[model samples]
Target chain A: MSEVVSALAGARASGMVELADAGATGMITLRGDHALLGAAVQAVLGLAMPEVRRVVAGEGAQVLWMSPDELLVITGYDVAPGLAADLQSALGDAFATVAVVSDARALIRLSGAQARDVLAKLCPVDFADFPVGALRRTRAAQVAAAVWRTSDSDWSLICFRSVAGYVWEALVTVAQPGGEVALYR
Target chain B: MLLLTCPCCGVTAEETEFANGGEAHLKRFGPGSDDADYEAYMFARKNPRGVHFERWRHIYGCGKWFLMARCTMTLEVFGTYRAQTSEPPAEIVAKIKARRPEWEGF
Candidate 1:
């Protein structure tokens, strides 16, 4: 098991912004017939993949609609191991591929009073329409990710594991005190 | 830019994600067809006012071939569905069955 580290520990921007550690979190990929995979995903995660321009939230999980036949599932830091196995079993030969990539992704939670302000400076999506229950599995800053607003003023952003450091540094830079700024990794 | 609705992706992405398939709903020409029919078949299409169905490729995202319904006059895109997605081919069914050796009796 890899040692868990805060996504933004040493990279703090002098009391301006803080980074939430999300390395321990798990990320999974679910692919199949959209309908069948959606059913299996809902059955296993208690959350249905949201429609295009929409999102469905669960207790500790989130389903972002990536494509018509692809979805990115974000589970709790410590979710059930059986979840992936069960999905594989249920999907069986129905899906073209079902990969449990909890370890393949590095999860991060970006939250602060100015989180939205920070995001607005970076992303092109109309954050005005993004609500608490809204999830957008689109690209931000030219990087594909699952962007969601956990609350009216709070948001969560995730990306592939390898680029987590770069994203964290970028977020920290923009989150500095006062106006928008940039940070280094 | 042409707006394409990806049924598989369920999003109306910009034409950037889609590739144009020559013509849609074309019929095969039979032997001894007339010259006029050949001309019409060779280079012609119906430029409709509303509800034009065409074939588009979702190249960037899913890489799945699908059908899209749009309005030519207004350029309003409606819905999309995968090619052969509605029903599986017999060969695909047989291949799937053969690949699943675990499903002996179930």
Candidate 2:
């Protein structure tokens, strides 16, 4: 099997906001009914099922409710393969699916006082109401993305691996000094 | 810009985040169907000037399909509901009826 690699290979840029590849984080996609998914996720990640369009954290893992029938599990890259198998086993013949999607995405971290301003320029989400722990899935410019605020000055984003390069460049350009709109500052 | 919400996930976002799936409650014609039925299913649409129900996909959000009832002329959204049902929910239909007294039923 070929070795997995991040799209940007840990590229970093220092501007009004710090934009860098957060590296290849493991991701597993689970699809099932609520009762079944809740049990399966708890048995495997020990994380509570997140509310609709929400994110829940527990122990060392995070569960994101991607849709009514879908969830995105975030965990260590090395453990993802094994965990996916475990999740499937936990589901146990019920109507559901679990697949490793770590290689299908790339993570980016944007942190600084101006991080919000940079992201607000590209995505259409209302940043003022987007508090910490709130998750939003929208387009950053043209590429689809799911973003969450870790703190007032820090943000994390994940997008398809194919568009990771574009997301990085877009963030870098918008993070340029003096580009700050200060609307979100 | 139209601000729509996905009933499945409860994400209210701008119209750009959704993909319009055309008029809602469409009766699909599959294999062995008559030519007229198939043609109507394929191309015919209700271009009502006032109240309307249409399907929308939260393409950038939850990626779920939902139905929205709104006025075609003003784009005033009446309500949005899950796409699982074969017809608009009674409450939404009633709301539309109350607002547009002369409007035809869904």
Candidate 3:
């Protein structure tokens, strides 16, 4: 049997932006009422439920508010199942649904001074208004993606596993030095 | 391109982030309805030049369906609201009326 490699294994860093595969991150899709889901997430991950279009980071987990009644919980890949289970137990019969979707999606981390610049090339969201902890579900190039700002110079983007390769290539292509032209900034 | 704000996620994104679901607040004409009523329900849409209500899905964003009230000609967005309601909220209707005095209620 052959071991699986990340889509960004051979991706070259552009110095201005660093791209890395956020290896085997755990992802859980949660759906339910805001109050119930928020409580469950806080109980399981010890992180406050983020406001709409925001993200909250805990010790080892991050909760992203995807919609009014939906959230995406991210943790270490190995711990995703356990987290989902914990969330399920926490919200049992509370009009909530929990599904482990770690393998359904791929995550990539972009950091450095020009990370936002690289993203602006493909995404339409104005990063200037996207403060840290802001999370947005938008299109990255041609693929559906969710982007979360983790820090001043860091962002994490997730796309479906099927298009991981395409998304990675697109980001790498735009992240290349002098590839991005700052139109908004 | 129109920029829409998804009420569910509070993310204001470009038109590309959203998929237009067409005229909102359509009353369904099910079986046993008159031909004219059914035809109107199926085909008739009010393409007003001024105030209009629309259904838009945040397809690439929070994936929630929402409603937007705006002026078709002026491109002035009155507001966006959740899709769960059967009709536009009173506040939104009032806002539109305040902006366009000749506007009629939905």
Candidate 4:
């Protein structure tokens, strides 16, 4: 099997903001009724179904509520296919649908004091109100993306793998020393 | 830029996060209906200048369809409601009436 490489490998970072690829993270997409889906998630992932636009974290896993009826499961990349299958069988005929989308997206982690400033350059969401665990499905520098605050100064951005290169370049250009994008701060 | 809230996800996102879905509460005139009635159903739309009810999708947010009561003239949003409803909610109609006294219910 050919090894998967991160889209940001060999990319230069501006230092003001630490950019790292959350390498080979597993991702699964699920959609169904809230109650049934929540129950299945709890049974399979041992985590609660997060509130709308929120995240529930467990040991080595995170469940992000993408919508009222949709959720994104994050875990180790190698474990994604098996986890998705396990969830499918556990929730057989109970939920609407489940799919493993691990290879379809690139997960990027941005941290440092200037992280918020860099994100602000891409989307119109008010980061001040985006407290920890808050997730927002919006555009990032013109690409469809979902952003969530992991901690006080850390954020995770997920976007299509195809545009990962563009997104990385945009972030790097904005994070450069005295980078013009920081004006948003 | 219209800012509307998705009732499903409770996210008040910008227009960029939504996709406009034209008029709401459209009644379908299927087979056996008169030609005129079918034409009206397919073509005729009440493009009222004020207090318009329309369908909107929170495509980038919740991926749920919703209804928005807006003013075409002033671009003022009256409110948003779930798309599963066949008609506008009574409370939203009351709000519009309170704001625009000359307006009629949908």
Best by TM-score: 2
As for lDDT, the candidate ahead, 2 or 3, is: 2
TM-score of each: 0.60, 0.94, 0.91, 0.94
User: Model 1, range A1-185, lDDT digits (tens) per residue?
Assistant: 76755344334343344456554666667776678988888788877658764567777877777666677777764663567777788777774567667766555566665666677665644465556766655454545556777775556777776776777677767666776543211
Interface RMSD of every candidate? 3.9, 1.0, 0.9, 1.2
DockQ of each: 0.17, 0.79, 0.79, 0.73
Between 2 and 4, whose DockQ is larger? 2
Measured against the true chain A, the candidates' chain A TM-scores are 0.80, 0.95, 0.92, 0.92
Model 1 lDDT per residue over B23-102, tens place = 45666466689877877887778766554557787665455677665557667554555676444334433443564434
For residue B96, what is the lDDT in candidate 3?
A: 93
Candidate 4 i-RMS = 1.2
Which regions in candidate 1 have their CA more than 4 angstroms from the true location? A1-17, A77-80, A180-185, B1-106
Q: How would you order the candidates by DockQ, starting with the best?
A: 2, 3, 4, 1
Tell me the lDDT of model 1 at A122. 58
Task: Give the Å shift of residue A137 in candidate 3.
Answer: 1.4
